[model samples]
Target: MNKQDYDIIVMGGGLAGCSSAIQLRSQGQRVLLLEQQRYPVHKLCGEFLSVEVISSFARLGILEAVRKAGAHPITRTYLTTSNGASLESELPGVGLGLSRYQLDLLLFQRAQELGADCLDGTKVNSVSGGLQQGFMVNTSQGNFSSRLVLGCHGKRSTLDLSRPFTGQYNPFVAFKGHYTGIALPGVIELHAFPGGYCGLSQIETGEINLCWIAHEKILNCKNSTLPDPLWQNPVLAARLHSMQCVRKSQHRLSQISFALKGKFDADVCMIGDSAGMITPFCGDGMAMALQSAEMAIPLVTGFLQGNLSERDLKRQYTSIWNREFRTRLQIGRLLHASFINAGIANLGVSLCDTFPALARGFIQATRGRDHGANLATSDI
Candidate 1:
């Protein structure tokens, strides 16, 4: 009705939403980007981009921007067991470490420059769908209609709370913060602990971003309301405890209610953590999110142009996400599951140390360089 306010309305101003908005605007489509928070918002993220993400950034013409914005260049990743046995692997292209506060804002500004009508501090309360008119999105500010709606909201939100997907379970919780005292020698680190694992990397700002995910059982043992002492498991407690200036000490916690799955149709494609998410053990989550957009945008564009049927768009989007992410997430989940048993995790560490080639292969696989049908498949 009334020709709609925008062609596309993207909810959530994170990497996925901003990227999608930018891409769509670059192609001469009018996009409306809504973010619940203003620019420079912080999210609990690994802060380390894989080689595939770096490559995608280059393709999107944002690599130089990232460099100029002081994103750190990471050349390798090091993994250590609870016993301190370590394994290292080199990255094909340098990964960049930039926090969501900086990265998402930069992308949002880029989208604005490309003609996206960005609305910050705008909360999307609900969305109603129709086959003919598509979706009517309700927000705190006002209502907007769009030919398509995209959910880029983070891990869990009111949107998901109201939507009610079947058979969802609260799986695990994640904790992350930024610290300054920890010393990292230009390598990203994954240190294994009980229940789950912790990641450490020196972001471009010289701050170490420490993130962890663990089962609810482990988190319940600490007795304190805070996560610091709870996270002080014998495995990684010493290393993380030594760090100082832990600004933004609050953990971005969320239960893994569901695996990474895009439930919406072409008129409403979900992206990033809003779609299902995998375990962060493999360090490929960011890569998957950005690359998924590259696949979804063309189909979305085709649908908007009336060149592709809505059925075709839904089939194509779901097919592409399943192909690209389903298995990798499964593999990551299996790997993370095995870590529950310290013996298995220690053994994995031993294997990695025994064979540097194994470490290299792990790096390649996580970076999306290991070719397979999931990556090579066409958007049928």
Candidate 2:
């Protein structure tokens, strides 16, 4: 019997990769995590983590670390449309406000503490293989072999080589920045404007996370930056009157497709943004990334343990992945599609308020059992 370099190789050490590393190491598996960026780097995200991470990472100690880091506790929501039609609702569960800069670093360190081999500043050029040939991963440093490879490479990566495996239609572009001198009412907020929606929440550092998503038309092609439409909507503008954007924290990503992504792409098991993006306006995409990690590691464990064949492992994982996320992704697309029309958006909220079941269904379907417990709008 020969030994592979690692039992598993996880590409891209964001939420999915790092969380997968932490869990697999916890289960006594040999895991290798390859990440391109150094720790503490900012990534474009709403930065509002679902409280669901509490029960999921309960044994991992990541939750406690988040709380200790001063992650704001949120139990309510405030939403405003492009027309400034505002409404408030109580959250069924608690949420945490912490930037990816903090969250990713914490998870990366936790994986290291648990003895998982993590390679930072290493970029994976490509991944190829199967049960018969085993898995071969080529990185900037060198090539390595593993029994299984999990692609957590985010929304776009070199692995989407050749033409592109994921959807590449008219996609949304997202922008994020940290701002000082702005305060919130300890609730999660989403403000809508033409072509985009912004999420506002306070993080551990006492700064507001001004993250928004807009149509690709808003991207500045020459500089790869998003124009300052942060104040285009009067409601959004009012919020920023006293706040100053943190130049260092500005981050943006273009071509954010809402098209349904596959469970597996290019022979690599895709998770997180690599798998598919959730609704920028309606759901907790961050938590969905963390949840993807939980879903894959267990099945991968079975394959490495020889309890399941490679074929069975992939089949079961796909089945489970579809079961857990399909409905949520579908709901997100519907929400995104409807949000395009302000009239429908306003009416949808009204219907949700008038018919509590619609709101509850939308929340449960998109947020899962973990959140949307008391949501008051959007399904209709």
Candidate 3:
């Protein structure tokens, strides 16, 4: 067998890509990580970090860096409707509210320190070949080849590969901005509106991350600017009154899809949003990204070392990945319906406020936990 230019090529420099690069490089594999954009930039994310990944970050030696970087401790959940009807519940455990600008940069630098060749401002035009015959990757910067590839290129990418879920029209358009002066300490607020819902939580710099997603048709203009209709949501209006935008501009992304994507796409191993996307309301997308990379490192290692064949590697990884995430994605899809309807959200929050125990059910339902598992709860 001829040696490829690199052992593994990780597509995109997001959480999953950088994470797998770090682990695979630590195991002596030659690694290359490509990102279309430069770092130290904000991404369209809720910036909510679940407690489940804390142990993994500690194991990866980045927990102290995260803490020192001023990651905020998130311990409470506040669910609200457009009318100001709301419910408060305790989170299953403590999570961190860290901005992607800080988190992704930290992971990118760590991967570089571990000897992974990290390249930014490189766009992937196409990906071909597979585990059996090695991979050929063409980027705006140059052409490269590797023994394997990890497609952490996010929910949508420049790659034109058609897959099972590609034909669906993705109706979601998302907006994110940073604001200050909102007293959201130790709390994450999920305020439901007509077209979509908004999330507010404090990040490392004590700034609130305001992210919301809605149907593209709801926007009065195509410029992706804030629509006044969004402010009509009473809960958001209250929060807005107490806060001011930290920046003049906001981040926007379109064509967002929550459809379940396979762990293997275009014959390349997939991770993070590439593999599957949980609706943002679940607050588990970031955790799933880190968890998928952790799950893939060993299989990626085995395949590269010739200990596992292509067929066995694909079967094992696909099976395990499906087992872990499929149910969560399905539940997220189901919950999406109830959340978007104004009447349902109004009634749900009002009922939940009256019965805190029932509100815990709503929390547990969206969270990626198995049925019959107990969730920690409290009343406020």
Candidate 4:
């Protein structure tokens, strides 16, 4: 038998890619991780972790490391509508506030320490071959072969255009920045405006992460920056006025789509946003990234060991992926759609205020089951 270059080659070294590399390596599989950018970088994200991920972090052995890096614990949520109506509720569980810059670096180092071959600053130009034939990955660093490949390159990549699962063009744009002088250490806030919403939370560095997403039309109407109506809400306005923007930490992205994404294509398993991006309002994208990595490990392991056929592996992974995240993404889309309408937005806030249980239920529904126990017991 001809030996392949690696047991697995994971493209895109963000949370999904890094975590997958670590998990696979822990199981004694030789893995290679390709990342186009260097470590400790910022990405456009809400930068909030849901409580559902605590167990996964503990299982991944990064709980302590994350805490040491200054992750702030959050237990409450505050939401406001464009009309200035507000609703507050206690979170079902404790969440964490940490920047991707810190989180990604820590995970990457852990993967390297565990013996996963990591190639930072390397971009994968193309991927070919199939499950039976193995895969030929052409990258800026060099070409390589692997029995299995995982795509975690995230939203809107050049690879997406080349793959069969290219989603429709979405006009949504997102902006994120770190700021100081806004206080609300234990609470996560989401303020809704016309065609957009903003999330503010305290990350480990003591700076507030202010991220907002909106339709391009709404932003274009408002001087092409902060939406004008966002300041109409007193709470959000005050926070915005008080924030001292961190120039170096600002990031932006355009053409974000919330459409359902294809899970498997060209014999590559998609994880994180590469698979499907949950609407940011749910604040579960980071957790979903970690969870998807956990979901991929067992299936990939079974396939590489010959206990599962390529067809079976893809089928089972797609089933598991749909089962785990489909509903949450659906809920996210519904909520996002509703919020885009001013009347529904205000009415929803009023209802949540009148019935706090409903608010709690909405939060619960958005967060899926905790699979930490399964991770703990799994050899991979």
Question: What's model 1's lDDT at 49?
Answer: 75
lDDT, candidate 3, residue 367? 58
Best by TM-score: 4
User: What tens digits encode model 3's per-residue C-alpha lDDT throughout 1-380?
Assistant: 57789999999999899999989988999999999998887888999887676766876778879878988888889888877687888777778889999999999999999999999888888888877788999999889999899999988876635876777899988999999877688999888888788889999888999988887777875445456656778878877878878784378899888988877876799999999899998888888888889988898899888899888889999998888888878888766667777789888778878888886776676555422123132210
lDDT string, candidate 2, 1-380, tens digits: 35789888999999889988999998998889999998889998888877566565565677678767877777778877766577677666777788889989999999999999999999998877866567889999999998778889887776765525444475677778999987885699887666667888988898999888777665544534434554555677788778787889998776676656676755677878788777876657777888888888788788778898767877888888788888888888888767655677677767776677777677767876665334222210
| Candidate 1 lowest-lDDT run of ten | 371-380
Off by more than 4 A, model 3: 221-224, 368-380
Q: Which pairs of residues clash in candidate 2, taking residues 3 or more apart in a chain or in different chains?
A: none
Kindly list the per-residue Cα lDDT of model 4 for residues 1-380, writing each as its tens digit: 36899999999999899989989999999999999988879988888888778787777778889878988888789988878788888776678889989999998998999999998999999999888888999999889999989999997788889654455668888999899987777899999888888899999989999999888777755444466867766778888887888878888888897777888878899989999998998898888988999998899999999999888888998999899899989999998888766779899999989988888788778887772323221121
lDDT order, best first, reads 4, 3, 2, 1
Global Cα lDDT for candidate 4: 0.85
On a 0 to 100 scale, what is the lDDT of residue 313 in model 2? 77
Output the lDDT of residue 377, model 1. Answer: 9
Model 1 C-alpha lDDT per residue in residues 249-310, reported as the tens digit of each score: 44567566546555583346788877777678877777777777788899989998989887
- Candidate 4 is scored at a TM of 0.95
Arranged by TM-score with the best first, the candidates are 4, 3, 2, 1
Question: Between which residue pairs do clashes occur in model 3?
Answer: none
Candidate 4: residue 172 lDDT (0-100): 85
Clashes of each: 3, 0, 0, 0
Total backbone clashes of candidate 3, pairs 3 or more residues apart or in separate chains: 0
Question: What is the C-alpha local distance difference test score of each model?
Answer: 0.74, 0.77, 0.83, 0.85
